[model samples]
Target: MQLEITGHHLEVTESMSNYIREKAERLKRHFDQVMKIHFILEVEKQRHKAEATFHVNGNHLFADAYADDMYAAIDALTDKLDRQIVKHKEKVKDHHRQEAAQLVAATETTD
Candidate 1:
């Protein structure tokens, strides 16, 4: 998976970049289908905002967060994305399992 981090109106320091990369990597543990992740960090007055767009398989997931600190914003953003990825994985698994069960039942009836 590819991870792209961009900053708006703020400089992305080495430590900040590394922190974001580390947190983003955790998503792979839940769902490996992630293709690419684009993160945008912005500072507006007193608010630090973080937003990310994730490309997993054929689906796109997006989440945004705001906090007084950049690190906190990034943490919130990742947590939201994590939940979405898990939900997506569950849906895919359930769909395939249901289809397979139906197929088996149909084959048994035909035989």
Candidate 2:
């Protein structure tokens, strides 16, 4: 997966980038099909905001968080994204299971 980090009002340092990358790896563990991820960090007055757009297959998932600290905001953002990805994975799995069950029922009825 590709990761791009952009800063709006704050300069992104090496440590900050590394921190985000490390947190982002947890997302990959949940869903390996992530195609690309774009992270936006902004500082507006006293609020530090972190936003992420995840590209997975044909779907796009977005999550954002705001806190007094940038690191905290990033942590929250990743957590939200992780939940979304897991939910998406579950939906996909259930969809295939439902389809297979319907197919089996149809074959049994015909036999």
Q: How accurate is candidate 1 locally (lDDT)?
A: 0.95
In candidate 1, position 74 carries an lDDT of: 96
lDDT of 2 by residue, 11-110 (tens): 9999999999999899999989989999999999999999999999969999999999999999999999999999999877757778999999999999
lDDT of 1 by residue, 5-57 (tens): 99999999999999998998898889988899999999999999999999999
In model 1, the clashing pairs are: none
Question: Over the full model, what C-alpha lDDT does candidate 2 score relative to the true structure?
Answer: 0.95
Question: CA lDDT, every prediction?
Answer: 0.95, 0.95
* Worst-scoring 10-residue span by lDDT in model 2: 89-98
Please identify model 1 stretches exceeding 4 Å from their true place.
95-111
* TM-score per candidate, chains pooled: 0.86, 0.86
Residue-level error in angstroms, candidate 1, position 72: 0.3
Model 2 misplaced regions, further than 4 Å:
95-111
